[model samples]
Every structure is written in C-alpha cells, then in structure tokens.
Target: MAKNVNPTRMALSRLKKQLATAVRGHKLLKDKQDELVRRFIELVRKNAALRKEVEEKLTTAFSSFALASATLNESYIEELMTLPSNDMTVEVIEKNIMSVIVPVMNFDYEEDFMAQPFNYGYLNSNIELDDAFDNLATILPLMLELAEVEKTCQLLAEEIEKTRRRVNALEYMTIPELETTIVAIRNKLEENERSNITRLIKVKKMTQ
Candidate 1:
C-alpha cells in the first residue's frame, strides 16, 4: 500500500487526514456495535421469557381444547370454531435503536372480547371449551409482544453485523494502510532534503 502511494507532502497530508477520519469512524462504529449488542441481548432475554410464557399458555389452552373436543360432538365443536369471536387490528410503527429501525406493533381489539369472549351458548359448550377460549384471549397480547421482540432482535443482529464489518475494516485495514503510507512519504521527503543540503554544500565549496 505504501509503495503504491506518491511519496510527496501532498500525498502525506491526504493520508494523514484519511487516517484521522478512519480512526474517528472506527471509534464511532465500535461504540454503535457495543450498544447494538447490549440492546440485542436485552431483547433476546425478553424474547425468551415471552416465548416461554406464550408456549405455556398455548399448551394449557390446547389441552383444554383437546378435552373439550373429546367430550363434545365433533360437528358442534367445528361449527363453534368457525364463528369469529372478536376483531383484532395491528398497527405497525417504526422505532429507532442505535440507527436501526425496528418495528413496534400496536394492537387494537374489541374491549368487549376480553370481558365476554365466548360466542357459543353455555348449554352447548362445556367448561373446558370456555377455559380454552379464555386462555387464548389472555395470551393474544403476549403473543404479539413476543413477535415484536423477535423482529427487533433480528434487525439489531443484522445491524450489528454490518457495524462490525465496518469497524474491522477501518481498524485493521484502512487506518493502518494510511498511517504506513504517511510514514513512508515523510521518510522519503526527509531523505530528499538531506541530499539537497549535501549538494548545496559541495557547490559552495567549489565556488570558494
């Protein structure tokens, strides 16, 4: 890299500037990577907890559903499942974390659904079916939250990878190349100065 560069003051100055910029950029990118990792770890932990809770709730709900299905008439249960109990609307918004844009989901649902979720008549449906529907209703928000956190972790991980590459390039390649080129140029310039001084001294002695 140093051999390719012109060993002149102008080249030296340019390389010095580039080295400074690379150093500064490396520092900034390193800081960003650190923060991204921190945020990613935090989201990962939250995602794990949310996933566990959602899975537990889903297991309980499915167990109740399985019991209901076994005890009740198959056609009756199928007909009841076909009916829509409530409506849910999800509004996705962007949130910035260390320059990474992640999704923030806002859920809008019928408030009445939480209060009275079951649509079928009590005479036809058993207690297990009611419990299943109730558990599903309770887990809805948690499921949405889990989705949001998982997505955020993905985005952060991608950003972190990109930042790490940039930091490594500046730290291990660009900055070092520029500094080496600058030193080579300075050494060449000093060598030329000494040769010029020797020539001037010989000329003065000849004139004398």
Candidate 2:
C-alpha cells in the first residue's frame, strides 16, 4: 500500500531520496547483525568450554575438601578455616565490541603472600586439604575469565536484537512504503499531462 503522501513532484523526489537512504541503512545494519552473531557464537562456545572446566575443577576441589573433612578433626579444621589468608583485588574495565560495551576484569594478588607457604602446621593439615586449596586458587583466574566472556555474549546478543529490528523495519516497511508512494505520484502526474494535451487539441480544433 502506498503511504499517505502528496501526489506531487516534490513529494516524489523526497520519497525517492528517503528510499535510497533506507536501503543503505538496511544493508549496514544487516552487516552489523551478522558480525555480532558471529562474535556472539564464538563467545558462547568459549563460555561453554570455560564453564565445563570451572565446574570440573570445582568438583575436584569439593571432593578433596570433603575427604579432608572426613579424616581430620572438626575442631582443628574449624580453627584452620578461621585463619586469614591472602588478599586479592579485582579491577573492572570496559571494552567496546561492535559498539557494545562489555566488562574486562583483572585480578591482583600480593606476590609475597602467594609465595609464602600455608600458615597451618604440616602435621595437622592433610594432603587432601592442600590439593583442594590449590585447585581453587588455580581456577580463580579461569572463573573470572568465564564471567567476562558470558557478559560480553549477553551484550552482543542485545545489540543484535536491536539491529535486527531496525533492518526489518527498513526492508519490510519503510522502503516499500516509499516506493509505493513514488509510483502512485508518477502515475497521477502522467494522467494529468495526458488530460492537458487532450484539452489543448480540442481547443485547437474548435478554433480552426
């Protein structure tokens, strides 16, 4: 259906220009959507792999802790848990991916603290407990990386949806409406020109 625009040369010119712009915009947006989807899929795959690794490591860590708990004295375990350990800090920064802003995280820990041995006595602490702590520490960076990737996928997904909507609007609605309106105006102008020619011929015949 044609848009409700005036059937005049000026309106037709304006509509043609609008149609051209809409077509260009649609192509650009479609390209953007494709790239965003590609990046999103890659991130999703990475997220899946990282999640699997993190879960498996966590399971190992938990199993070790459970074994240690079963073999060790509850009071002593409680005392060991109460002791303060190393301090870690996370710094959050933003990065742009296809105009979408996502978070990047950096972790900082004290080098001296990490270099030192466990505070607990060797006789009281079992190997299982040590393994559990080591596993948890090793996966800390992976856990942080997993978080960053998941958030990036989320942001890209949102942008893709928005771009898809715009592309659809231009492809299905705006461009079609302008084309229909321009065709209608051109037909009307031609009809008026034919009528004028006919009237002039009749006037000449009568005068002759």
Candidate 3:
C-alpha cells in the first residue's frame, strides 16, 4: 500500500530523499549486526573453552581440598584458610565493540598468588592443601576472563537483536512504503500532465 503522503512533486522529492537515507541506514545496520554476530560467536567459543578449563581446575582444586580436609583437623584447616594471604585489587573498565560497551577486568595482586599461600608451619601443612591453593590461584584469571566473555556475549546478543529489528523495519516496511508512495505520486503527476495536454489540444481544435 502506498504511504499516507501527499501526491505532489515536493512531497515526492522529500520521500525520495527519505528513502535514500533509509536505504543507507539499513545497509549500515545490517553490516553492524553481522559483525556483532561474528564477535558474539567468537566470544561464545572462548567462553566454552574457558568454562571447561575453569570447571576442570575447580574440580581438581576441590578434590585436593577435600583430601587435605580428611588428613587435617577441620578446625585447624579453617583457621589456617581464614587468614588472608594475598592482597588483590580488581579494576573494571569498558571497551567498545561495535558500539557495545563491554567490561574488561584486571586483577592485580601485591604478592605472587602462585606461591605458598599459607604462613603456617611446613610440617603441619598437607601437600594437598598447597596443591589446592595453587590450583585456585592459577584459575583466578581464567574465572575473570570467563566473566568478561559471558557478559560480552550477553551484551552483543542484545545489540544484535536490536539492530536486526531496525534493519527489518527499514528493509521491509519503511523503504517499501516510501518507494510505493513515490511511484504513486509520479503516476499521478504523469496522468495530470496528459489530461492538461489533451485539454489544450481540444481547445486549439475548437478555436481553429
């Protein structure tokens, strides 16, 4: 159906301009959506890998901790672990990916997290306790990375959906309506010109 527009040359000019703008915007939005999907897929793959690795390390860490608990007194183990070992600072920043601002995380520690996290006597400490602590420290960065990737995936998914909606509106609705209106107006103008020419010829014949 033609758009609700006046069938005049001025209105046609304006609608044609609008159609041009809408077509350009549609192309740009479609391109952005494609790139966002590409980036989202990449992040999804990375998220899967990191999730697997983190889960594996977490399982290992829990197993070692459990073994250490069995060997050590529960109260003593809790007391030892309750003391803070490393000073950690987490910095959050945003990076723009296809106009979607996603989070970037940085973990800074004052001391080596991979080092022995306990300040207790070596003779009293179980090997399993040290192994568990090491594994936990090792996976800290991976956990943060997984968080970032997951959040990025969510944000990209939302932006891609939004862009797709806009592209569809322009491609299917707005552009088509404008084109129809332009055609209807052009046909009206041509019909009016023909009528005017025919009337002039009739008058000339009558005068002759």
Estimated TM-score for each candidate: 0.96, 0.92, 0.96
| Residue runs of model 3 more than 4 Å from their true location after superposition | 1-4
User: On residues 1-208, what C-alpha lDDT tens digit does candidate 2 reach at each position?
Assistant: 3646777789878888998999999999999999999999999999999999999999999999999999998898788768767778899999988899999999887775444424677777889988887787778889999999999988898899999999998989888888888888899999999999999999999999
Tens digits of lDDT, candidate 3, 8-96: 88988988899999999999999999999998999999999999999999999999999999999999888887979778888999999
Off by over 4 Å in 1: 1-4
The alpha-carbon deviation from the true structure for residue 1 of candidate 3, after best TM-score superposition, in angstroms, is 5.8
lDDT (Cα, 0-100) at 144 in candidate 3: 95
- Candidate 1 lDDT: 0.89
Q: Point out the worst 10-residue segment of candidate 1 by lDDT.
A: 1-10
| lDDT (Cα, 0-100) at 72 in candidate 1 | 95
Clashes of each: 0, 0, 0
Error of 2 at 166 (Å): 1.4
Clashing pairs in 2: none
